[model samples]
Target: MKEQKGKQEGLQHDELGIKIRSNDNPYLSADLQKKLLQPRKLSSYFIVLIESGTITYNIDLQDFTLTDGHLLFAMPNQLLTPPAKTDNLKYFKLLFDENTLALLPQQFSFLVNPLNAQTIVLDSAVKERVIKVFGILNQLFLLDKQETDTEIILAYLNTLLSELNSAYFKNREPVNLLNTNLSKFIEFKLVVETSLTEQPSINAIAEKLALSTNSLYRIVKEYSGTSPKDYFINRLMTEAQRKLRYSNTSIKDLAYELGFNDPDYFSRLFKKSTGKSASDFLPRQDLSGE
Candidate 1:
C-alpha cells in the first residue's frame, strides 16, 4: 500500500517490500513522476543506475548530477528531490526496505557509507555486469507474486548488492569487517546518529562503545578525518541545516529541540560550523513546492 504522509510520500509496498521501475518497461506515469520530483523522505533504500543521459538529484539538501554509468543511492529516511525533467534518461530504479536487506546472508558495509560518497562511477566492465543483473531482476519482478519464486529474486538481489558493494569501494581501502578499529568506528557512527538529539558527551560515547576516550579519538580521526568532538558537532549541524531548510521552526525552538541549553550559543556554533547564520541559511524557495 502506498502512503502519502504530509509532504513526504512514503513508498510502502506489500509483504515483499520491494519495487522496481525502468524507463520503458513498467513505465512511470507523469503524475507519479511528478510526486517523486518533490522533496520527500523515503522509507526504503533507493538505488538508481543511469544507463544514459543526465539527471540531477537533490539528496539530503546536496545536489548530485549523474551521467551515463553513474549510480546514486539514498538510505531510508533521506530526503530526495528528483530532477524536474527526464527527457532522454534511460535508467533503472530499485527500492527495497530493511526487511529485504535482513534476509541477505551477508552484510553490505557500503550501505552504512563510511566513505561518505553517495554517487559511484561504474567502469565499462562493471557497468555491463550491473546492467545485466538489473535487467534480470526487472524481468523477475514482472512476474505475478504467486508465480514468482522468492528464492530466485533474493539470489539476484544479493548479486546486485555484491557488485555495488565492490564497485563502491573500488579504489578505496577495502572495508574489512574483521578490522577491530573499523568495526568500532561504524558502531560509533551508529550511536551518534541514534542519540544526536541528546547531544551526548564524547566521554559518554566512548564509554558506551567500550573504548577509552583516546582510542575513540584515534578511531574517529582515522575514519572521518576529524576529532570526535568535531565529528559530533558536524553531525548536529547537518541535522540543523536539514530542519532549517525544510521546516518553519524558529531558531530558538530549533535550538532547544536539538538539546541545546542556550539558543544564543547554538546560533554561534551554527555560524562557526556553516559560515552562515540560521536565518540566512533558510532556503529562498520551498523545496516541497509543487
Candidate 2:
C-alpha cells in the first residue's frame, strides 16, 4: 500500500513484478494494514488464501465471503474492495502479472476462469500444502532481489498454481486442454476482448474464427450458456459498468467511447442489460468512501 505518484490505487510490487504477504509478515505494519481497506483496481492476477476468520470482499460490485480454508481469485482490471475489518483474519495474499505468468512451464486454465467460480474451498490437506508454498514464496521474496533465485520462485509458483487449479476443478467437470470446441471458445473470448470497442458483428467474429454462425452459436452456448451475440453484449455492458465506476466520463462520451453511434441507444441497451440507468450505475460517493 505504498503511495506512488500518479499510480492507480492498489498494493504494488517491486521491480520483480510479484508480491506476497501473509498475516505474519513483519513488514505489514498497522498503517499498511489500514490501507488495505481501500478499494483497488488490480493490475495483476491476485489470490487470497484465508487461513482463519471470515471477511467479505467486494469484487466488481459483488460481495463474496471467505473463511478458513477458502481461496479467492481476482483477475487483472477487476475492482477489489477489501473488507473494512481484518483484526482476526489470517491470510496469505499473492500478486503476479501476466509477464510472470507467461514464464511458467504450463498453462493454468483456471486463470482464464472458464467455470466463472472465483472462490475455491480448499480441503485440509490442500490448505496445508498451499500455506507451506505461500510461506516459502514469502521467504523467497523477503530475500534481497539479487540473492533471490527467480527460477526457484517460479517453480514454487508453478506448484502453488497447480494445486489451486486441481482444487478449483475438483468435483466439477474438468476442462480438457485439448478439446477443440473449448479452444475455439477461448479464442473467441480473446477476440471479443481485443476488439470490444469495435463491436463487430457475430457473423464477422464467426468468419474470423473460421466457423459458420450456427457453429459459433453452439460453441458459445456450450461454453458460456449464452448465444454469441448475447455474450458479446454482456461483455460490453460489463465494460461500460467498469468505466462508469472507475472513471468520471459522462454517459454520452462513454457511449461513444464504447462504439455506440447514439448515446440514447446505448442508454437503452445499458438499462436492458443491467436493469439500471448508467448514472444510477455509477459508484456512490458514500459507498466508495472516496
Candidate 3:
C-alpha cells in the first residue's frame, strides 16, 4: 500500500507539491500492496538501491522485478507502487531534498533524470560498503538531538544523496547524454515549484519559456498525461489537502489564501478532485481554527 496525504514525490513538499519527507525517517515497509492504481506519488526524487527476496516495483510507468540485489531510481511525481505480496519484503530508500541539490555545482553532470538509470550488481564487498552508509544514517537518527547547524545537517544529506546517485549510475553506458526535452521538463518543474503561487497562468509560463502554448502543452502532456492547467491545479489541490489535514487554518480563509474567490467554490472543487469535502479532508476538524 501507499502512504497517504501531503507532499509531492522526491524532494518536493509542503501544501503545493509532492514533498520528499524529511531524511531522518528510516522507512522500512513490509506491507503488501493490493491496490490497482498506486496512491499518488510526491514530487520528490527517490533513490532506492535495495535488496528484495522476490518482488515487483513499478515506478514512473516502468516495472522492474528484483531478486536479491537491484537499484531503482524514480523521478519526482511518477506514481509508485507494487503489485506483489509484501510478506517479508526488505528494501532501503533514500529521499533527497531540493534545497540540498541546489548547492551541487551545475557543472556536476550527474544523473538527475530517471530515464538515465544505471544499475550495478553488488558483490559481497560492495554490498557491505553500501549497507554501512545506511547503517551510519540509522545511527545518526538515534543520536540525541543536538544543537547542530541546519546547514551542517544539509551538507551531510547532500553527501549521502551524491553517493547514492553515483552508485545508481555506475558502470553504465551513456546512451542519453541528456535530452533537451528532458532538460525542459526539469526546468518546468522548478518554475512550477517557485512560481505557481502567484497564480502563474499557462500563458505566462509559456511566454516566459518562449514556447508557444500549444508546443508547451504538447511537451508537458506527452511527458505527463495531465495538461499544464490540470497539473498546476492538481499541484494546488495536493497542497490544499495537506493544509486541511495538518494545519489549523480555517476553511474560508484558506480558500482565499489559495487564490479561490469563493469559499463554496473552493470547497466544491476540493471535493470533486479529492473525493472529500475540504472539511471532511481534515484529519480532525475539531482541532482546526474556526
Candidate 4:
C-alpha cells in the first residue's frame, strides 16, 4: 500500500457531502489515483467493492487482501494505506461523512458494529446485484448539478447500505437482538468505542449502562468472546498502531491524545496487547509484493 500524510485523504468532496470514485468513470483522474496511494485516516465512512483484482491494503494495521468479488470497509479515523502496485485493479469506492449517514433511516444499526468484520467475499448472486446498484450510484455521482441530485443519490446510497448491512451479519451466528442481554451487548460496544480514549473503568461503564458489574462481564464475554477489559485494551492498541503508522506524533503525545495520563503504562499495555512495541509496529511492505 502507498503511504502519505493525512491531509491528502479526501480525493473527492462536494456540497452533497458524499463522494464516489470508480475505475468505471473517466473522471477518475491520475491526480486522484496518486492521492489514493498514500497512508492516511479517512474522515468519512469508506466502502470498496472489488470486482476483478487482487490487491493488498492496510486497515488499522491489519493487512487485508481484497481479491475479485470482495468488499471491504473502513470507518472514520481508521488508518488506510493505498493498495500496493497491482494489475487489473477494478473497484468502486464510496466515501461519505456522518452528515450523509444521518440523512438515512436510523434502522441501519450495522454502521455501529462495522469493525466486527472488515472484509467479506461476495458470492455471484450478491455480486451481480451489488454491481447494478453501484452502477446507478456512479451515474448519480457523475451527474451535473440538479435540484434532485442529492436526494436521488442519497436514496441509492441508502439502498446499497441496507443491502450491505444484511450481508455483513449473514454468516455470523444469529442472535435475538431483542433479548435484553443482547441489546445491552450492542450498547456496551457503543460505549466502549465512544469512550475508548478515556479508558473508563469497567465498573463505571457498567453503571452508566445500568448494568451490574457481573452482568456487564457476562454480556461482553458472551457477545464478543472476550472479557470487557481485554476488549478495551485491544481497541486502544488498534488506535495506537494507527497513530504509529500514519502520524508523526511522538509516543508521549499519542498516549496523551488517547487519554492516558501515564505514557509508560500505555506503552506497556500496547506491547502486551500486540506483542510489538509502539515504535516497532510501523507499516512494512505488503508481504504479497503487490
Candidate 5:
C-alpha cells in the first residue's frame, strides 16, 4: 500500500512478478494501514476485494465508498488514498507487475481506463465465488517452496480474472456493441497517455483511433462524462499535481517537462484546472498547523 518498491515482508512473489497479501497476513500492521490511507502511486497493478466492512477511498480524486462484496482496482501510477480510520476493514490485495499481466493468455480490456470505476459491486453468488478464488490465491502465495508452481498458479489466476471480467461487465449497462465502445475508449486513453506531453489535438487522437471527432466526443462523454479535450487537459493537470506533491521540480521546469511551450500558459491552465495556484498545490511542510 505504501508503494512497495521491491519485495516486502509477507509479500510472496515469483519470477513472474505476481504478489498477494490478505487481511490474514501476519505482516499487516498499523504502519501499513497508515500507508494505505496516504496518497501513493504503485509500481504494479493492485486489486482488492472487500469481504467485509466499509471504507471510502479516493481514486484519481474521485471518491468511492466500497463495502462488503465489492472489489476495487488501482492501476500503476494512479493516485490512491483512503481515510485513516478503517477499524472494521477486511480484504484481500493482489499485486502483479506489467510483465506478469503480459503473461496472461488474454488481455483485460477493463484495465485500460477502468472507466473511472474504482469499485465493482458483486452479488452474493459472485461474492462467494470471489472469496473461494481469493482463498486459492492466498494459499498459493503462502507456500514454503523455493519457487512457485507457475503453471498451476497461472491457471487459477486466469480463472479468477476471467470471472472478475465477467462480473464487472454484468453490472454495467446492457448496451449493444459494448465491446466496440470499450475498445475505442481504451484506445483513446492509450493515445492520450502516450501523447500527453505533446498536448496532442483531439482531432489527431480521433484520427489515430480511427474515430471521427464527433464519435470520439460521444464515446468519451458516454464513458467518462467529459469531452476528449477536457479529458486530455485534466490528465495533464493530474500529472502536474503529482509532480508538485511528490517531486522537487519547480513550476517552470515542471511546465516544460509536461510539454508546455509556454510556462505562463501552463501555470494559467493549472490554476484553471485545479481552482488553485501552482504554489498552493505544493505539499505542506507543517501537517499539524494545517
Candidate 6:
C-alpha cells in the first residue's frame, strides 16, 4: 500500500516504537513527485537496490554511493541523509518492520543489520529478481482500486518474501556457522525466525531443537558472540522499531501485540533498546491533518 505520500514502507509510526519509513512505497502513482526525494529514516529496516542513476545513502556518517544493480541495506534507526536530488534514478526500496523481518532466517537477516557492512551487490540476474518483487507489488496495487485487490496484493507480497528466503538465503554457498557446529546454529536461528515471541527462554529454545541449553549457549556465543537471549531481543526490537514509527497502533497496544503483559514495562524495555521513548519516535503522531 502507499503508506504515506512521503514515506514508502508501511505506517510512518505505530505503537511498536519502530519505523520502516521509505522515500517511496512500492506503488507510486505517476502523479507523485519523481525527483530524488530527500533522505530520511523509516520506522523499519532499509533494503534498497538501485537500478539506475546515482543514489547516495549516508550510513554512520559515511556516504555509500550506488549505481545500477547495487544493493544497500541499512539497519534500524541508522542516522541517514537523503540522496542529493537528481533524476534518472530507478530503485526498489523495501522497509519491513523487525517483527516482519524477525520472520527471516538468521543467515540472511544479518545481511541488513548495520552492524554488518556486507552489502551484496548482486549480478544483474539477481538484481532483476529483486526488482521483480516490487514489480509484482506495484502491478497488483496500481490496477483497479478495490478492497479485494489488496488481498491478492498481500499474497504477492508473501510470495516475494518467501522466495527471497529460499533462493538467496537458504540455498547460498554453505558457510560455517561461525565456529560452533553449523547445523545446530542454523536450526536454532530457524526456529527463532519462525516463532520469535513464542521462544521464552534458553532452555525452551534448546528443548525445541533437541539440544541442551549449554550446547546451544556454547555455539551461540561461539558464532554470534552473544547468548540466545540477546539475539532474540535484537530481532524483537527490530520489529518494535518498524511498528512504532509507521503504524497507528499505540505503544500500549503494540506492547500487547509483542507479548508484553504490561504496557509500562514495554515502554521501559523499548527505551533501553532504542534510547528513545515510544512517544518520541512515533511517526505522524496523533496529530490530525488540518
| Candidate 4 local lDDT, residue 82 | 68
RMSD of 1: 6.5
Better of 1 and 2 by TM-score: 1
Candidate 1 lDDT tens digits, 1-290: 12212212232223566788786474467677655655676789999999998878888668898999999999875767767656787899999988778766677878867787899999999999999999888877764545655656767888999999999998776677667998999889778878989989999999999999999999999888899999999878877887787678989999999999999999999999999999986755744332
* TM-score-better candidate, 2 vs 6: 2
Model 3 alpha-carbon miss at residue 177, Å = 7.2
Q: Which of the numbered candidates is closest to the native, going by highest TM-score?
A: 1
TM-score of each: 0.85, 0.83, 0.51, 0.77, 0.77, 0.49
Between candidates 1 and 3, which one is better according to TM-score? 1
lDDT of 3 by residue, 1-290 (tens): 03211111343212221122123443334332223323346456665555555556665334676655565656555556534344555565656545445444332234444334434456666666666665554444445234333333444555555565455556753324256655666677667767745668899888888788997888677555768888777777876775666567888978988888888998988888778788876655331121
Candidate 2 segments whose C-alpha is farther than 4 A from its true place: 1-16, 25-43, 77-85, 287-290
What lDDT tens digits, residue by residue, belong to model 6 across residues 128-239?
A: 7767876666544344334333234445556655544344343454343353465677677667666765647778889987888888888777656788888788767766
Please provide, for model 2 over 135-166, each residue's C-alpha lDDT reduced to its tens digit, 9 standing for 90 to 100: 88887777554565566677899999999999
lDDT (CA) per prediction? 0.82, 0.81, 0.56, 0.75, 0.75, 0.59
lDDT per residue as tens, model 5, 1-290: 23322323344445658788777673345677644444666678888888998767666766677799988888876776555546677888788888766656666655654456667788999899989999888887886444665656767877888777777777574333247877798778778767889888888899888889999999899878999999899988988887786578999999999999999999999999999999886775421111
Worst 10 residues of 2 by lDDT: 1-10
Question: In model 4, how large is the Cα lDDT of residue 13?
Answer: 31
Q: Global lDDT for candidate 3?
A: 0.56
Task: Please say which candidate is ahead in lDDT: 1 or 4.
Answer: 1
Q: After the best TM-score superposition of candidate 2, give how far the Cα of residue 225 lies from its true spot, in angstroms.
A: 1.8
The better-scoring model by TM-score among 5 and 6 is 5
User: Which ranges of candidate 3 are over 4 A from the true structure?
Assistant: 1-178, 285-290
